[model samples]
Target: MIDNEPHKTKAYIAGVNLNDPNFDYYMTELANLTEANNMEVVGQSRQNTEQIVAGTYFGLGKINEIKSMAHGLKAKVLVLNDELSPVQIRNLEKLTKLRVIDRTELILEIFANRAKTKQAKLQVQLARLQYELPRLHPSENSLDQQRGNGGSTGGGFANRGAGESKLEMNRRTIDKQISAIKKELKKVANQEDIKSKRRNKKQIPKVALVGYTNAGKSTTMNGLLKEFTDESSDKEVFVKNMLFATLDTSVRRIDLNKNFSFILSDTVGFISKLPHNLVESFKATLQEAKDADLLINVVDASDPNMIQMIRTTQSVLREIGIKNIPMITAYNKADKTDRNYPQIEGNDILYSATDEKSIKLLAKLITKRVFANYKKFNLLLPLSDGKTLAYLHEHAQVMKESYENDGVHAEVRLAPENQERFKKYLV
Candidate 1:
């Protein structure tokens, strides 16, 4: 921690591999992350090396240059946009005389602040421990003192009645902590299983909002919910603007119309270059997307890389084992687009989410998509049998209704599974 209350400090990027096209984007996101954490970027340095030094990540010349720059700017923090090995971290700290952190640590810190639910906090702690385990290499400064005194080959304590490496003990401790965290998560997963079973029994059609981070997903959700419910009573609908905003799943019951309605679920956002381990840990949270009946893959219309973001979103979806779900692309932020947006493959629907016409079109498109799979039915019920008519109207979308001499005649479209409920009136 800085002695002076963490003033926004200048920093720069180092150890960049230029062969990868995504390197620039990753560095840009790193800048964004730093800004999010209340830091300022004074400069950035890039290198074309494939293998970083085992000690200092940058070459000795580059390290000396960095040292001078840090002293010149009085930079308190050196943010490396890549995961540095423990030795590299130690070397950088000694050379720069500043707190050195990698992308993993930076992300975990952001997660630490954003985590709201019990499960999210646990997962963040797990990731943090895993990251800190390696970097927490016991003070070699003390180890050097022990070595100077000729206590053992290495500076620190030993194991099994013999001098063992300090690194070995640290590794063992990390392994133990990882196992314990996994056990705790297993218990949480069991509770999730029970909750999922209950939701299945209710058989409510689920629509999940999924997209890349900072892609206005939460904004879209707030707009959609605000359109459906009055502002005073829509307190349950939560909206936030941050990386991984909406970490915990928020389920809202939306009334599509008088006859058909379903639940809309907003979930955690995805990011480019998201660590595989983090993705694995967030599987349970992402199960909401997997179980959704339909996915509104929200895209930022103004972003130039909408196609790449869409691909990344789909890749994450497939990683979580969700395929074959009907999807509608919700091209959000259309009002901000310079010109009218072009269409994408697979049932694309364009809307600003802030526009009244756009939101109505979205609702209509959702209804049409859901009803496309429904089986058409024409039934005539006796006038005396009010129970059956009410049941039909409640369970299925009754497109047309006519009063008949016998009772009422209704033409409706309903899912094949729901058709069984009205078998008695079929004629």
Candidate 2:
């Protein structure tokens, strides 16, 4: 019988430590990223150095040691913990005889693989092209060949007529593609902007869920939607126990009751040292968070690296220009820990997203924080003022309402803006 198991690329992950305290955690994350990209991490190496070698990332001796050890381990790819310069990548590949993939490229490849929506696809493609443009070299036209059309012919052909090498033509083509993708992206963004403007006009409070990848954000969203919204498969976002499972922003209206409703958005999760290009390209998708009135920073309480993960989320939020937004730290996965479930400490909640009681408590905490400024009002509207009564029902949290000879009498919680609108009806 012939053995026909599928082959997985054997990858050796390595990193140079400049005495950073988080070096080990970074290496662990690199290994996870490699696995997420469908490669098997076969072995690992690390070097402690005062400074990185400008031309080769690792010193010559370290590189030689890595080369020998990787060969012994049957590893065909060298995965680095940090992004490398193009020169460093080429030099390492030459020295080690293994294909070199740096941290940034590895992350971009994952995003490319995970992108499902057109906007996400275009964003990843734009970022990839931007990353590749400067890395393009004359000798690497073989890359184009590998993709297809190996010979110097077709559009990339050196127009023996123009003396442009296929390399230059390839660069030109990428530039054109980048421009075209940007134009299309802008059009899509404009459409999103229109919808966003409409949502803004409603003046509903917006809350965004942001956290580290695989931290159970999508699960939390599903829980909220299930409990607070009409339960439907379409209302649920994708949930999986994997990195980067969600690439697009999902926005839903969360109706807590007849009295309280707010817009909720779940955004792409953050990772440590995410590729700069990826972050830049996904800014549009993160707009929901940037525009939010409050943010629920969900965290994996069971993870040992919880503190670092929290910092990573904060760093990414700042990079995206989100500032001074009120945030509640939601420590999820409390079931995996000995701590109490659905416990609130100040503005933070420790809970499991899957537990119904925990979800309810989380919702209560969110409602309390997001609606803290709302004021209670008692109003009486005349029978002819049915429109005013309807407005109160739609905009304010109507706590109590009854039909009377005067018209309609109600007690409601009114947001600051609506407080002014209903002042004339106050009793």
Per-model RMSD to reference: 5.8, 3.7
- Expressed as tens digits, the lDDT of each residue in 1-427 for candidate 1 is 5587676767765655848877777777788787666678777777777777777888888888877887787777888878778888878898888888888777777778888888888787787776666555444423335567333445434432343345566567677888998899889988987987666555556788888877766776676677776662544545555566667777776776665666777888876666666777888888888888899998887777787778878888887788999999888887787656333335777678667667767877777776667887888888887776666655666778899787688888777778888778787
TM per model?
A: 0.79, 0.89
The numbered model that scores best in lDDT is 2
Q: For candidate 2, what is the lDDT?
A: 0.90
lDDT by residue for model 2 (201-284), tens = 666789999999999999999999999877647889999887899999999999899778889998799999998888999989
Indicate which candidate wins on TM-score. 2
